[model samples]
Target chain A: MKPSEYDFVAARRRLEAKEKSAGEKLTSLEDAAARVTNGDVVAVGGILFSRTPMALVHAILRERRTGLTLVRNLMCQEGEFMMAVGAVERVVTAWFGIGLPWGVSKIMREHVEGGKVVYEEWSHLALGLRFRAAAMGVPFLPALTMLGSDLVAIGPMKTVIDPYTGTTLAAIPALYPDVAILHVHRADRFGNCQIDGYPHMDADIARAASTVLVTAEALIPDEEVRRHPDRTVIPGFLVDAVVPAPWGAFPHECYGLYEADFEHFDEYAAAIDARGTAGVTEFLDRHVYGPASWLESLELWGAERLARQARRAHELVPATDIMGGLSTPPKPPALGAPRQSRGAPRPPDAFTGYA
Target chain B: MTTIASPTEWLAVVASRQLRDHTTVFAGVGVPLLAAALAQATHAPNLTIVVEGGIVGPRIKPGRLPISTNEMRTAYRATMLTGITDTFLLAQRGALDVGFIGGAQIDPYGNVNTTVIGDYARPKVRLPGTGGANDIASLCRQVIIVTAHERRRFVPRVAFVTSPGWLDGAGGRERAGLRFGGVSGVVTTLGVFGFDPTTRRMRVDALHPGVTMDDVRANTGFEVLSADGIDTTAPPAADELELLRALDPERRFLG
Candidate 1:
């Protein structure tokens, strides 16, 4: 379908219809997942391996939601698992891979190849801009990306001669998801969300979606949230429900909370390698379905293992003591300082010699 | 003195030499990050490393390199932490000097394909489609592709153009309405490649030490051209190897 055919007006109406109440918005994971019905355009917040809404995704899977269109900047284990279990019929994403040592996701590849799923590819910037357009209530935004790439031919983006510059620009349509599930560091009972470290694309995703469901690591008091108004990425008015799921983005790292469970990824990779779709089913049975709740799922991995990951997270980003403010301002080497002077003599002309 | 550098170490070292000091580089994950880290640790101390995950000017920690760009490790000592939209907007406004990325397939025209191995619809191998690659390639001042050189990878024509190089030929980018940025070179395991000034076809500009013309010809699917008096890529120096090894002590990326 052409991007022009998208129901922008209906999307706007849906957003307008949502209650803007400032009352307690806290809810259960299953209840929050229930906000997402079948065939909904669901946008998941966070980038690959970080801050992904895995708890909500698990909840959605257990709810047996199907025919959903999954959206994200980068597709990781959550998207792969969703596709593996037939929860997703389509995926609109920039990239889909396990990344690094794991490489591409075999399940995603098989699904796409077998014609069981439709994958709509877009450049990362374009996807982000699309969400931004939706958040801003604009129909489309012009961009310089995907001008000469095959994505131009395949994706929804179309080029138009710029009226001002006489240059061609790819017109990216505004993407309004039916529901956006986000994982945040903290959120108030009233649903004001704050994210530590990098806010991948959650802020825009929250605003762009008609219904926003947030799975936060902790539910802080409204007074605490008010103290750091500058850190609130998702305002309460935009949020419909908030599920306080600790270690919500487990197996995937949440900045300042814990490191990614590489051992679990290794186990997952091995499982998929050993048995394809059946392996994914077995994983879900053992981790997702077998356990009644997200917290119960966490118990599968012993406390020592979870603690080690949290310790590693602290080590990686020493300034995790947010309430106390930055303990030590990062001191990077002086720009252009000759740090290598003590080692090897600088090559005469490393840049120009090759050409 | 001979430094027994692994293939990836050699690629990282050669790729690092491509960057100038104090330039803002949009670095992709894996080897690109390793090379950028090495560059910052060595010659380009002032180099600003931008990850698509919105991390800018991060002092990449040794041995704890982020497997994914958005991981907390990538944000350690980062000069700026912005959203993905704002970060890519920086590139769109021509703030980035270099874009360092890797791909599964590259054509003679330097066009890269990380999307699919066979057909787009029903593919033999479906890759992790273009993330920020096409954006970086389209907006950055220049792009450098770092990938393993092999016959299957160096295709006569990419099945799908996830990132545009010089599309078709000489004025291809211009004809296609791309006003800024084009591939400058491709740093590979076997050699360093450059594009022809007029034709824009891939050419062997510098062969890495111990790699032969026959190796280039045999591995590349397209007709490989050679630059006049093509210089041999300098071997990884002792200090460069030390820095690269230090960054990847686990050999997670260096291998």
Candidate 2:
């Protein structure tokens, strides 16, 4: 569909009607998953492996939600699993893969090739810009992405000539998903979410979607959230439900909480490689369907394994302290003769003491 | 010095040498990350490495190469932690000096195709579509492509242009309205390839140690061009190999 064809005004009206009162929005995983109807445009939060809302995805699968259009900037196992289980009808993403060590996802490749799923492509920046446009309540945003690429030729991207410069620019349409399911570091009962480390378009996705369902690792008090208001990436007004789901992004890394379960990924890769969709179904039966809750799902890996991931995560230096006391150095002058910089003096070397 | 470097190692070394000291590079996953890390460890300690996941100036740890750019390991010692949009905006605003990426296939004009192998509609391999590759290639000042050298990978024309290199050739990018930044070089397994300034077709700039022009010709699907004088790529220095091995002791990416 074209950007002009999407009803941004109606989406805004729907969001405006959602309860923005300072009341508890906390709910169970099943209850949150129920908000996502079949055939809805559900934007999955996080990029690649980090901070994926896998627990929410599993809950949706458990609820047997199908024919959903999954949208994200990047897709990994979450997209792969959903496709394997026949939940996704379409995926609007810039990239889809299992990443390195493990290469392209076998399930994604098969489904796209078989024409069972429609894989709409865009550049990573363009996808993010679409969310950005929606969040800003605009129909489209202009960008330099996908100018000469085939993505422009095939995808929904449109080009316009800039009257000011006469340069052709890509007009990225707003992507207003029906719902956005996100995994956060913490959130309060009222859905004041705080995402530590990289937010990775979650904030934009939350605002862009009409309904926002968050699965947080921890549920903090509203007092705690108010203590550091700046840390709140997604405000309570934008969120419809908050589900406390620890290890919600399991098998995937959650910043400051745990590392990705690489072994589990390897096992999943092997399973899909060996048996394709049937193998993924076996995995879902064991992990998604078999477990009673998100916590129980993590238990399938046993306490020792869970503890190891957490321990490894904690062992790494916190991002704030990684380069403590070391300031960024001034960029070295270019090899060629220096370009005129409006009469500004050359900065001193900040690396003098450190390096 | 007697150690024989693997193709990946050779590619990484050659790719790393393309990076200048103190330049900011937007590095993709796998070999691009490895090469960036290697460059930082050796000649470019001050190289500001930016991963697509919004990690800037990270001190990449040894033996713990990140599979995904968003992995916390890539966030280690990061100077700034932002989001995907903010990170790419840096490239868009011209803050990035280099964009290092890898692909499944590349055309004569250096246009990369990570999207598909055959027809986009059906019937062949559907590779992972463009991630931040197109944005990086289009926005960054210079882009370097690193991938396995094979005839299937180096095609005369890609099935789809996932990343715009030189588009059709010489003035293609300019005509396409991409004012700056086209592919600077492509570091492959057998040799280093560069674009002809006039035609913009990929040309053999240098063949790696022990690799012949015939090997490059046989491996590349396109009718390859040779520079006025093709140089032999220097073997990986002992220190370069040592540092690369230390970074990937498990040979996760090295292999």
Candidate 3:
């Protein structure tokens, strides 16, 4: 093939226009849901329901989309809520429910028992590693987790041996989701998102999916996005759409946002225990389907509850609280208390030596 | 009127008593949190509590229990924020001394069954599958098996082996190539059980206060092994109950 004539001046103008069109990335939740198709494997971010994109998910549910494969880590309220709304067909990940003495949620258990959903469980490491593999464009990730367990036999996981050593190893095939939805503390119109606290696996999921939709608590100015430039977790080019949804993570913590609504979760769990699947629907109808939008749903919680639960990052200056509420230790633990197990955490390979 | 102790309260204290100094405990939530918190405050103040999500040594807040190990509270004051790979790598290297596990059923050999109740392909009841519990049970140097003591849960043979405790009656775990760990204790609402040294089978080490040997045998599906002399467990001290309640003020997980 012969090279064609290049137009440098016009190309430069187009690049400048693209950079200035940052506001174009901002869209409504309805438009974000429009990007989702039935049967799409959706990667939902947030660990244990903390910092989930509630508005985006509610909008997606209103569209009446079903048969979607959900990739998740914790089976918290999001999994159960989706199941009640008929938004999921299968779940691939580890853990559902809080564990005994409460046990897994009745809704999740009933769905599995009725064969409404297939549960493919994996170790947290294996699940996360697979997402990283997909993000890196690899076929599989070799890991040491689930090596001598039954999850490998029943799920997509398999055993591969090192040809040189003849030692068996576990592998999780890459999971490239069609869409990834994440909720973050803040982001600019350009989709440069900042996750205030623990980013369980959002970075990996966003990179692995073909399209990334972010629902942020606030859409800040370009300066705020670049303030701590090096701390930028999600790069703008990777994002497909961004929505500003306040209280985006309801019934769960959002770091400097608000405390996890333990009151509601308890009520939901008890309702399920008392009425089984029927209880799940009642809670959903009242809280989920009934609301016209995420902000409107705030009326259900009332202003007093929200104000009481509000947790600002500055309040917890030295340490980041999970629920954003303040907590003072009963007593400062003895600094050099007789050492236990000499296994105090060592710095990771990446963080070390750089110092 | 003085209130009677609930099973959860009794079990948490009984489980916490098992902790000794200089031991790393692995568990996620519920009784494990209550027990670990109680131990850290009262007896073993220096205990290093490890969560599966790679959060190690967090000063767990008393009034709030994180929903899962994945929650940021688990990493609140954690000295090391290693992910699952590093946490398990440390476990495989024989760092953890005690691992706490919950199960649906347990056989005499201590093989845990959390997969299904009746059949393999089609089960009458399907449980949420293992989430690194298999590794916790397989790799830790010792494990504290916490579960109900119903005839249904204490079975003759588990339907499926989700986490290996002890394979047949003898050297099954060793035969399977597990590098470290075995069932050191089984903490139940009724009593505590330890494995036989020579036979490697579970036997009653001690019974909780007010529990009878016949009661333990009746609740268990399999034969309840007992030695010539079995000790009785002491009741929870007044302070222990006070601390346990502090760890879970709202009874969020305990209830």
Best by lDDT: 1
Positional deviation of residue B33's Cα in model 2 after best superposition, in angstroms: 1.4
TM-score against truth, every candidate:
0.93, 0.92, 0.81
**lDDT of every predicted structure (CA atoms):** 0.84, 0.83, 0.71
lDDT of 3 at B113: 70
Docking class of 1: medium
TM-score of chain B of each: 0.96, 0.96, 0.95
The better-scoring model by DockQ among 1 and 3 is: 1
Give the CA lDDT, 0 to 100, for residue A36 in model 2: 93
> Order the candidates by DockQ, highest first — what do you get?
1, 2, 3
Chain A vs. native, model 2, TM-score: 0.88
For each candidate in turn, give its C-alpha RMSD to the true structure in angstroms: 9.2, 10.0, 10.1
List, residue by residue over B60-166, the lDDT tens digit for candidate 1. Answer: 77778888878888888888888998999999899999999997889998898989877787888888888899999999999999999889899898999999999
Share of native interface contacts present in candidate 2: 0.84
Itemize residue pairs with steric clashes in candidate 3.
none
True contacts kept of each: 0.89, 0.84, 0.26
Model 3, span A1-355: residue lDDT tens: 0010012233234333444334558899989999999988888888665777777778888788888888877667777777887789888767777444466567877787778887777776667777777766666766545655556555556677767876666756777777899998767788887775566678878867777899876566676556567656888877889987766777676664566666677777788888887787787787768988776766687755665455322232232232111211111021111111123232222211111
Model 1 stretches with alpha carbons more than 4 Å out = A1-6, A323-355
